[model samples]
Target: MKIHEWQARELFEKYNIPVPRGYLCRNADEVRKAAADIAKPVVVKAQILVAGRGKAGGVKHASSPDEALSIAQDMIGATIKGIKVTSVLVVEAIKPEKELYIGFTIDRAMRAVTLIASSEGGVDLEVLAKTEPEKIYRKNIDPMVGLHPYEAREAAYSIGLSDKSANDFTSICLKIFEIFNSVDADLAESNPLAVRFDGSLVALDSRITLDDNAVFRHREYYQVDEELSPLEMEAHAADLAFVQLDGDIGIIGNGAGLVMATIDVVAHFGGKPANFLDMGGGSSVESVYRAVKICLEQKSLKALFVNILGGITKCDDVANGLVRALKESQLKIPITVRMVGTNEEEGRKILSENGIWYLDSMETAAEAVVKSAYSRN
Candidate 1:
């Protein structure tokens, strides 16, 4: 589950991390009041789950209550990246002497929690990680021993921090690590952890994603984070384990293991998956039909990739449902299918009759769909 930035800031403050004072406002009047209360230059940020809000005009700076109110008027009820904004955060804007980033997340390959620190700023952390990995300082922590102070300091110094700020950053890293473990978070990070002219540090923004499996232990947080995307609500009602993503490729496969592998393969081939939709074991035709329909509901998809390893679920049954869903949908997009196991020939025959391409290898199908998706652009 993803929590909004305001909620993440509250979590940060609870750990004694320095953060700019902010107020969560539902409408323009509250923003005006918050701006007047702060009595300083403030940033009006849209409270949406997606990132890149600033470029989408969901975030703005206001020097006075009037400007803040004007910005909030435009921001509230606006859609950013397909999600409507119902609230805005009016926070005191900080003048930074330098900007840096620090985040804690599970490194699957290392099979441990990874602390990543970067001296670079203004770029997306993910992009930085992919493009300029040399600038990033990484240290994987053993869950049993926890994060060591020396390791934290090593990361801070490697990111080019001075004595005072490095010390504070080390403490912040420890606190973030604590928050990561205690909150059962899948991801927790402060982007642009800023150093002010006076040499004090403050987190300019934060993001936190809790593990869905551990939500039972953190039930209190759901009170404020009850809002779900329309797609997620629909998927939940349909009884599909689905999660929306900001990608153009749609993924569907039988079983959690196969779905995960399909998603990774799509990414490996440079295709972004639009959602995580697991069709589950022994899926009936109707279930497969509904799952495909769910992926089709996302109009942004350029191509759909389906990987099915038939066992108890017959490959031919899944194919009938998949073809039916594609034929019924108005928004006709490219699709690639890879099927193996029981009744593969019948499945291939059904797909071939419908003019949908079939590949036996997941990697080959992933490459085809990725190519089809990018060719459109």
Candidate 2:
């Protein structure tokens, strides 16, 4: 799950990490008070989960308390990347002598923990990786031993920090690594990790993304970030696996592999899938209904293709879920369904009686779905 800057800073504080002094305020009056507490030259940051906040005019420099309140007022009600900014984080501005970037993330292809650091900071690391790959340094961590002192120190030195800040930098890196492992996070990054004039390291920006499967171990940490969009909040609230894509046709299936195949088959047949939605194995009617509703909710979606291979998931249950969804949601677009295994005939019969379209083969289903979408266009 994604969290706002304030939430990430709070989490950092819990780990004894050095973060800038800040106050989260929902109103202009409270913002003024926070600005006063933090003193002049504060920063008014829109508390949104989306990126590119700086480009959206979500971050502003306030030279005085009055300006802080004004900037906060402007940002609190503004929208950034479709997310309504209901609050702003008022933080003390810093005088940084140097800036660096440090991060820890799972290297999926490598199947190991990867630590990355760069002498450059305050920009998208991906862009940096593409343009100046030599500036970024990466090291693999052994899960059993954790990040050793020598390894962290080596990363710190590699990022171009002076020998004086090397130990402090290593300490911070160790703590960050601990946080990543403790929370089962997929990524933990701090851009512009500043070295102040006094030579103290502090995080200027923080981002943490936790593994969805690990949420079971950290339920308390799963508190919803108030800055998320309504659609995002609802998707998480419903616990439906969803990934937004860009295409005209929406493809959904019961398994992850099946969903991938559905998208691939559609693409092979000259159709682009708008999203990959999976109901997962052994889902109920409510879950299935939510999956369909979520898929149909996409404004770009021209049609839905549901392909399910029932082994542990019964075909009848899939059919019943589709029927219930059709009854509940007044979906105007056509849906093409393909069912295989375990009571497939019964599922096909149920769908036919409900005025829904069904096909036996995956290729035929994909063709029908693509045809329905293009026909409407």
Candidate 3:
């Protein structure tokens, strides 16, 4: 669960972290009012979950209220990285004398919370890690003891901050750690934590990803709209795990591991998977039908691939669902299926009766589907 930047800033404010004066606006009129209230050169930023918003023309500078309104009008309905921007953050555009990066996240490998800091900011951390690994400083917090003040200060000085800014930097890092633990967050980051000309630190950008499993503990935080894609919402309703991707082949499998392996197999055969749909361990006719319907509904899908290795899931049941889906909908795309394990013979018989052939091997089925997709192109 990712929260919008404005919401992240709200969390920061709750923890006494300084942020630029801003207002979340849904329209031009509200933007104009926010700009007037701020009474400074403001930055109009599209409030969306994806990155690279600045490069996608989602961030603009406005010197006056009218300019803010105009920029907000252009951004409100704009799409950035496939997510439509429905809101904008009108914030004071502070000219930073220096910029720094600070973040806290769960370090899965270490099985501990980690604090990461860098002298360089306002850039992608992944690129920084690759290009200048030494610039990134990290400290793993002990779960039993939590993040100590000395450890926070150590990270602050390692980032090469001036003595004047060290205390403020340390304070912010400690607060960020607190926010991370308190909110059950997977990640909480402040990119380009700005140092104003007067030598005060302010968070220029904020990002927070909460742990979805812990949502029950923080019901109020999870009340915000999820902004899920239409297909994703449908999958959620059906209790299936589905993720859309950019490809021509639609994939469905009984388990997450199987679905992931199927995607790898498709890619290995020079084919891309359009989506990942896992019907869970015990798939029923309704689940399979819904998954098939969702995948077939995707635009630009050239072929559908169903790979099932049944253990708890019976192969014949899966075949029944596929045949029912085929009968109910106009499936324009070709389908390739591979079924092995429990009740395989019965499953194969049912598929053959419906004029569909089942492949015995995943490799052959993957190759056939890849060829079919390319031929259609």
Candidate 4:
């Protein structure tokens, strides 16, 4: 799960990462108070989950308490990418002689920790990857051995630091890696890791994404759960993996592979999927209801594509669950059903007799859903 910047900075401080002194403010008064207490030029940053805050006017610089208050007042209720900025971070500004980027994340392809570093920092890494790929460097780290001191030094040197600074930077990288492992973090990054004129380093910004599966072991992290959406909370509670998308077609399939194939089929048929819902082997009425509710919550949705190839699950059971949901839910959207294998005839009969559209092929269902959704749109 993604935590706010304040929470991420707190975790970074705990891991011995040097960060600027800052105060989390809920209102403009608190922002002024923080700036006055610090008695220095400060940066006012809006705290929100979305990225590109700068472009959205969610970040501003203040040279005095009055300026801080003004910026905070203007930012507090402002919307950044549709998310309201409810809090701000007032941090003492720093003078940087140089800026660098450093981050650690799990590389699923390599099944190992990967370190990303570059001389270019304070900018989105994806933009760098797309525009100047050669400027960035990636190194695979063995979790078993951890980020060794020698390796860290080499990485720092590769990023073009001096002898002393390289060693110091490497030490910092090692500490950050230790934090990632200890906290079970999925990803952690410090953008524009600054080298001050006095030869010290500090994190200008921090981001941390915790492993949701490991949250059970970190109760403290769970306490900061105000950022979760209702659908996300429901998906977590049901232990049914789901992802919400932006489209008009809701899809439910039995297998992950089948779900992906269904998505491809819908796209090919000129439709976009609203969500990825997998009922899996549990074709029970409760599971179906849960899946249907998830789909129904998508206000843009106009049709559902229920494609199930029942192996261990009976087709009639799937049909019955769908019928039961239709009876219970006040959903107005149409559903195009596609059932195959394990008493398929009964499933077809059940849907057909009820006047629910049942297609014998996935392609037909996709075409029908696309047409239905387009007409509604």
Per-residue lDDT over 1-377 for candidate 2, one digit per residue giving the tens place of the 0 to 100 score = 77667877888889988999988899988989988988868888888777788898988998888988788777787777777889888888887888889899988877789999988888789999999999999999987778898999999888778766787789889988988998889999889888888778999888888887888998876767555446656766787666767898988788888888899999988898988787889877778878887777788778889998888888888899889877887877888999998788888889989988887799999988988888875
Encode model 3's per-residue lDDT on 251-366: one tens digit a residue. Answer: 99998988999999999999999999999987887888888888787888899999999998889989999999988877777889999988889988999999886797988999
Worst 10 residues of 3 by lDDT: 219-228
Off-target runs (Cα >4 Å) in candidate 4 are: 223-246, 330-333, 342-357, 371-377
Clashing pairs in 1: none
Give the C-alpha miss distance for residue 238 in model 1, angstroms: 2.7
RMSD of 2: 2.8
The local distance difference test score of model 4 is 0.84
Q: Which rank order by TM-score, best down to worst?
A: 3, 4, 2, 1
Count backbone clashes in candidate 4.
0
Off by over 4 Å in 1: 222-232, 241-253, 256-277, 283-377
Tens digit of lDDT per residue, candidate 1, span 1-377?
Answer: 88889989999999999999899999999999999999999999998887678899988999999999999998899888888899999999998999999999998998999998999865798898799989988889998899999999999899999878898999999999999999899999999899888777899998899998898899876633335677877887787888888998999998888888899989998999998898788888899999999889898889989899899878889989988888899546788888998888998899889887888999998999999988976
- Model 2 TM-score relative to the real fold: 0.88
TM-score of each: 0.71, 0.88, 0.89, 0.89
Model 1, residue 250: distance off in Å is 11
The residue ranges of model 3 lying beyond 4 angstroms of the native Cα positions read 162-164, 219-229, 245-247, 267-272, 299-302, 330-334, 370-377
User: How should the candidates be ordered by lDDT, best one leading?
Assistant: 3, 1, 2, 4
Where does the lowest 10-residue lDDT sum fall in candidate 1?
220-229
